[model samples]
Target: KLVDYWSDPDRMKQSYRNAVNKAKNKVTTHQGSKSFAQGRHEFVEMKAIQDESSAKTIPPMKDRGILDEVLKSINRYCTQEQFEDLKRQHALEIEEKRKAFESQQKVLKKFVNLFNRQQGTPSSQF
Candidate 1:
């Protein structure tokens, strides 16, 4: 019978408390690990985007025909004006992303500073 399992009130309370603590610990650990992994992934993606942008080298005007030929091959239906507009839009998007990333980095830095100050210890020291 179920009564046989929980015949003692004190034992039942202790068991309940133990179960609650275990659940809390599991949830806390899971959340902390998940947040750490997500932050790492975001950092890696941001760095890769920044690296690709920085490594871009604009070809000389004389060699620009190669770029045009490649673009033409891929977009035979697109007009020259449309292609130029596309390039402009792509550049604008990249610039906007860079600005947004910079803003996020600034906010993250401020949060980290406040967190460290509240904890009363430098993160590097830890």
Candidate 2:
């Protein structure tokens, strides 16, 4: 729907003008890392769409910086609640794996004990 709206020539021109005006009146102060990252991502996406629709190709946007910023934002956004949730999940997964391993070991031990008993050997060695 956004792409379709952007494809309209009259609307595209208006949008381009709006973008230029916005840039001219851009805010100086940072609006936190999350919003800043989101805004940059949206701006790059819009620029790419505009370039695709237009005849004249504009210089490619600096993608590496935006990507790095996004990664940093994600890392920074890991609040205590989210961190605790992740920690809980990790511990749960580890516990489940440990249980599975213990069960396998128990089964192997039982098999070895049964084999020893059949061969008339002591089961205590296993």
Candidate 3:
């Protein structure tokens, strides 16, 4: 009977949905697991990277199976109202790159200033 129960397509679907929901915990729409999301994001990011010589300006990335199972689980198990309450979390990853660039500029500026000062100094060994 237990085997027959799971063998039923509808029952199997329901069981799978239940399991997915349990894993999702209270998540409504966003990522289920942080580590899972991070790993998937990294994979997507790597795949999205464009060749240096490519004319494309921006790396394309969207709904790239990063949360396919979670989204499907939500659609199957979650109420529309509850799902609507869930929001995707987005971090400002670009800020880090921009900050690094700014620091490099500061270092370059200091080096240039020192170079100019040395250039202005007369040769002492003459």
Candidate 4:
């Protein structure tokens, strides 16, 4: 039985792919309608978030089951110094992104102020 199951993994995978494709087509076809589009957008956004969470190298430390077990198993393969280096790298990336966003916000604010001042003219027909 185990051998049979292992041999037929491709068929199982194809079936799942077909089902997902059908669902995606349905969503895209219905997206022109306002309510359906909103619902579909929300569903897609949620799926993206789920995919991101699944792809993360670290899971929350509080869980005690399969996810946590898998994380622990992977951790066993890494040294403490290596893990610390990875953490530091991630922190630096986050800080750089934060700084870039703040700079963009400052530029946008200056543009808004300049536009407002340009429009702050007095009427000539007083």
> For model 4, which pairs clash?
none
Worst 10 residues of 1 by lDDT: 58-67
What's the true lDDT of residue 98 in model 2?
A: 100
Off by over 4 Å in 1: 1-76, 123-126
lDDT, candidate 1, 1-126, per-residue tens: 678768788879999998987777532333344565574665565555455546665333322343344223463577677689999999999999999999999999888888999989796763
Preferred candidate (lDDT higher): 2 or 4: 2
- Each candidate structure's TM-score, on Cα atoms with residue i matched to residue i, is 0.38, 0.41, 0.27, 0.35
Candidate 3, pairs of clashing residues: none
The candidate maximizing TM-score is 2
- When summed lDDT is taken over every stretch of 10 residues in candidate 3, the lowest stretch is 61-70
Candidate 2, residues 8-51, lDDT tens digits: the string is: 99998998998897799666645556565577776687656555
Which ranges of candidate 2 are over 4 A from the true structure?
Answer: 1-77
lDDT of 4 by residue, 1-126 (tens): 877875797978987898887787643444445575566666665555555567884452322233333324453466565679899999999999999999999999777777766888433422
Off by over 4 Å in 4: 1-76, 121-126
- Choose 1 or 3, whichever is better by TM-score: 1
lDDT of 1 at 102: 100
